[model samples]
Target: MATDPVTDWATDFDHTDDRWAADPFPIWDDLRSACPVARTERYGGAWLPTTHADVTAIANDSEHFTSRSVIVSGHRPPVELAPAGIAPPISADPPFHAASRRMLLPVFSPQRIAELEPSTRAYCNELLDGVRGRDVVDAAVDYAQHIPVRVIARMLGLPDEDGDRFRGFVEGVIEAVADPREERIETFLGLLHYLSPYIEARQADPQDDVISLLLASDIDGEPLDPLMVVRTIGLLLIAGIDTTWSAIGASIWHLAATPADRRRLVDEPALIPTAIEELLRAYAPVTMARLVKQDVTLAGCPMEAEDWVLLPFPAANRDPAFFDRADEVLLDRSPNRHAAFGLGMHRCAGSHLARMELRVALEEWLRAFPDFSLADGDAVRWSGGQVRGPRTPPVRVAP
Candidate 1:
């Protein structure tokens, strides 16, 4: 379905619009100054909180805004899905949210993430190996997009050959936000059908994978239902791949455009970690949604019950009041408290893994192609909807 172009950003903003997909910083800056909390009639009425203060407050105050339907679309999930939303932990609220989240923490712990680094690094090089001889390659497609897909597939004990299918699934779930509710539901149903076989296999033959782990996990000594396992795995597949790849692709796009930053990172390998944090701040990919639990006024906006509130973490990361030089990317900026991984209880559980993939991705890419630039700046394409990142960041490397 086609959406009308946004005539006025303040009054009628659509996150899935092209203007937003290309570059949203200026829009966010304008909103922060003019209307910190911009309301729109789109998506059955939604609110966008651009300031760090408002975004943070809304994220923490789950009582007023339920995490039930984290994605705002033409159709909202049934209210009964609350407390344990479509996806557990992330979509689950409060008491149920805590237990659901705690069960998965051990798998994503620092130690566990570190254990996966060597393999992750190996995979990075393996991807780079494919485009070694090419003069021009899409850093987003040739490299960034495949890393998390393969990693997440391995973690879930799925076939690596399913990468393309996984990307399609990610696109359907994340990028097709503005599509009709029926289409959105169909997309989810397709994913569930695709995952049904794998879920059954894991149940019959448990393995050292995330699917098996969730199957064994229980909340309050009550085993999670099969549908819950499917939903969580679906979350892992969609969230784990899309957000990390977008971050990696956007980071690569930045390094390709900014010669000074690229050269510095190439020269100072030790600065990659700090640089990655700064990159995440500047190009955070994920923007979560919340369904209003009840009527409330936040930052002067009168938000009604069931209104969709978009938590634009990228916008919050750029709020001047929250961080010094909020607009600029300082590779060595310390004490950086950016909401790249989100904020409050719903914070990303796989953050450690994301950082590791991004760091290794950059390190390996820079090591291989130390000098590269955008093949054509105009050709670069960014995905629309809640998750924003370059979909086609083509780069030209030295022959």
Candidate 2:
């Protein structure tokens, strides 16, 4: 069997055996400059896109680059966790995706998110209140991780008590690299089973919450299939909880590491929105997967059908071709079209909500403890690939 170099790169990319997760940008930089489109032998002969333009082009052209299943690798994600992986005509292509996105957009619209501001602020303040007198606090666990899960759970009409358990389940699913594949599959199955009753209950008695709304939604005048509803909920849970948690942690870490950036925001509270965008761009939380539906040429390279495309948004955000001083935290980065929320039809529906959460978090933290730093002997680091985030960010409050 002649192995594909692209699949090999993807396999290596997936395992991160080379510790590429620690700093994947460098690898992306090399790929963007040298081999914008390269073959990896790992993902069963899939192609990998590393450059900004290539990724952007593909992400925008959902028609050409379909998103059905795992595009980078032909493997099907376990059925228990299959909603995200299932691609179109229905799952992979537009019009259908566009309609699905529309059904869920209002749930996270700017106006709706504004209504969530008070609660989000309260959550941030409540978390910070716990460590008010303490010298050091694990921001990742104590603060960052809690807000997103709690808020998202509330949005989904789930009880607050389930927040910690749900977070644990998601963490297990995302960080099960060392565990057997069966364990990961079982974990997600358990998650689905656990939520099964809720789905039924919501169906029987729909409410104002996202789950209830989803349960009652119709696509093209057809009631959403139960399986699709479950999958959509699963996607929301993972995206809303994990990505926001990671972003909050990363944002706090970035602030702690660079006191100047913190001070700038502190002095000009109005800069929080710009600061948030810059932070999101600097630390893209989600890795994208797209499938090649047909033979296509991009960035002077050719890709055949079934080629897996991994769009490294984090790397693209840092590309010099698009960003000036891509590494630095420019709080006032205007006209920043970084694909943090992704691009096109399949872009994150909860982005507005995530932005509101982050903005309020930063606001409350700075107001509550203006002078804060990483605790002595405590350093922050990130983990996971498809979902990257802080291992634990420790902050020392200066009272």
Candidate 3:
């Protein structure tokens, strides 16, 4: 609880602290009860919304709150990467966002995602097969991390060999808050360099990949801008990899620790889907940002133009006002309107693909280790800022 000498508001909202990183819910629980919209002095000064309604309101009222820099630290694109600072639909607002999303809609449409489900399932089984005989497995690194990276690589049309590096770049970009500036920018440059050739190849020889789809998309009367294509791919790469991976990892971590939940899923596989949703609600793990575009009073808190506000969707998922037993994980909880994938216009474009990946990953993991628990000696360590999940979740599988 580091106090902001200047604001004196987020006196207890130090996101970089080890305690907060280890377990933020307790801190968020306090804030939701005390101040639903608490101000934080960290990350160059910003406001955080904890309650489900307030977070939802901030997400929905984009007119008052812009989506230019979706990070509380604020988006500062290196001159070294691409000409454009941040990519669209994620970085752009309203009409521009709508137009950009229209171009990307084809790539993430329900039908397109449905077509990829079987292959995603096969990939999951293949990943699990490599570690089935082992007594110990890292549900985070070994399983959860692998699913989304490969799924995203296939969509980006990157060669199979590039998946590992793809995952690294995603981590580097998403974890930039606490990471070194040089390292993070270098990762951005790395992504650009890797995509440069692919973007060029797509222009010359368009194929079935997302690049080609973007190249073919039209805005108004003409083809979508080529620069926009590159920017959109960049956004997709970051969004596609981390958001689902964190969700999947959190789900696995929860099940590994709770035998009753694990047994229920294993015994009645039919409940897996709803169970997944319940886990998603209970362990939702994304916190995005929006720049204040106009003066607004949200839940009595004053916000000014250009000021940044964080939309911690995970906190919103746990808001007692919206979900019953909000703090507890209900394996088959229903009527859940969780914002795990966000809400309103900027709702996750890759949600269908993400859902398919999570479903497949969980199903295969359970099949491999019907009854698993966190390794006795080691403990689950969580990462904070933007996304939260176990980075090193060691699960023991009994023979």
Candidate 4:
């Protein structure tokens, strides 16, 4: 049997390419059919998983494919990811991941997130209110970016004023690829220092927020480690904010580009929930990765221990075998079991919270501006192949 040249070409991975941010699905599709599980020359020579089934298998079989390593290569692991990377036998295995995940379950329960709907909607309304009279606005800057940060901050019981500071810190960290190494280190250290006092305050005087809950949580009757608490909070903040912000940007971009689709959504406002699922499926803002814990064969390919596997979720969501007309945005996509929030025990803990935020934001935004389009001469920019979405989506609103 002859090896496919398409697959061979895809094996040459580049984690820091600007082109990947523009359109990775076309490359991912070619790789999935030609080489579902293949090695990549990028990331110290890692394996890349392109198929939906392959990603699901790895995500579910955490014992074989572990999350103990930082999902991405080429950067220092964030302090928050340290505990997650060491998630343990439970982290790697079952019952333990379940048990550890259970500790924070209540915090993100549907009811808890639902309780936040009014506040989330209010925040969206407030942001849009400011731009209501304006002819144009960058959804990324005006709405998509602000809503998540505010929601996360409010959820953490942090002051609203810290939103911009945290945003700066995150932007600095994410844009580290473009900045000098020393500057990146300085930004990370600054973030750590900024978070230090919050960790201390949470310890001294706990509150109703997730951070306090984590700080006060105990596993097997032992209190959670304070450092672990800090790391978890940091991860939740970054994960909840950045990925969703980009997703919001992408979803809006999609709606603006497709007039009929936007019209359908605007007319049947009830479709917002379904639209959220479709948006997530079509524009998965986050790309994830895992490490091979031991030598294993997947889709006839032998993966060695310590090999990194990049799970391109956006690509998987568009798999034709799993979805019909996968590229088209079908607002009411029933049985849409996309991997947008991931799968298995390590699934995103804040999935429900994120959904609620999106639902409210979309419902409110469409109602306010049904005739919106991308601003003239403005193009969308994206970064981080491992984690990506539109960097800037300038949109013009019409009355």
List TM-scores for all candidates, in order.
0.99, 0.89, 0.92, 0.90
**What C-alpha RMSD separates each model from the true structure?**
0.8, 3.9, 3.3, 4.5
| Superior by TM-score: candidate 3 or candidate 4 | 3
- The runs of at least 3 residues in candidate 4 whose Cα sits more than 4 Å from the true structure, single-residue gaps closed, are 1-9, 75-96, 172-188
Each candidate's lDDT (Cα)? Answer: 0.93, 0.74, 0.78, 0.74
> In model 4, which range of ten residues has the least summed lDDT?
1-10
Model 3 bad stretches (over 4 Å): 1-9, 74-85, 178-184
Which tens-of-lDDT digit does each residue in 1-399 have in candidate 3?
A: 233333333443645455665777887888888777888656655788888888888888867977766755534433233212377787777666787777777788889999988888898888888888888898878888878888888888877777678777766776556555676667777888878888889989998899888888877777877776777788888788778888898888888888899999999999998888888887877778877777899888888776678888888888888888889998888877888888878888887887888888899889878988988535777766677778888899987
Decreasing lDDT order of the candidates: 1, 3, 4, 2
Q: Which 10-residue window of candidate 2 scores lowest in summed lDDT?
A: 1-10
- Candidate 3, residue 311: Cα displacement in angstroms equals 0.0
Q: Which regions in candidate 1 have their CA more than 4 angstroms from the true location? A: none
Candidate 1 residue 108 Cα shift, in angstroms, is: 0.5
Residue 179 alpha-carbon offset, candidate 4, angstroms: 7.4
Clashes of each: 0, 21, 2, 2
lDDT of 3 at 189: 79
Best-to-worst order by TM-score is 1, 3, 4, 2
What would the per-residue lDDT of candidate 1 be over residues 1-399, giving only the tens digit for each residue? 669999888899999999999999999999999988888999899999999999999999988999987887878888999899998879999889999999889989999999999999999999899899999999988999999998999988889999999999998888888777788889999999999898899889999999899999999999989899999999999999999999999999999999999999999999999999999999999999999999999977889998999999999999999999999999999988899999999999999999999999999999999999999999999999989999999899987
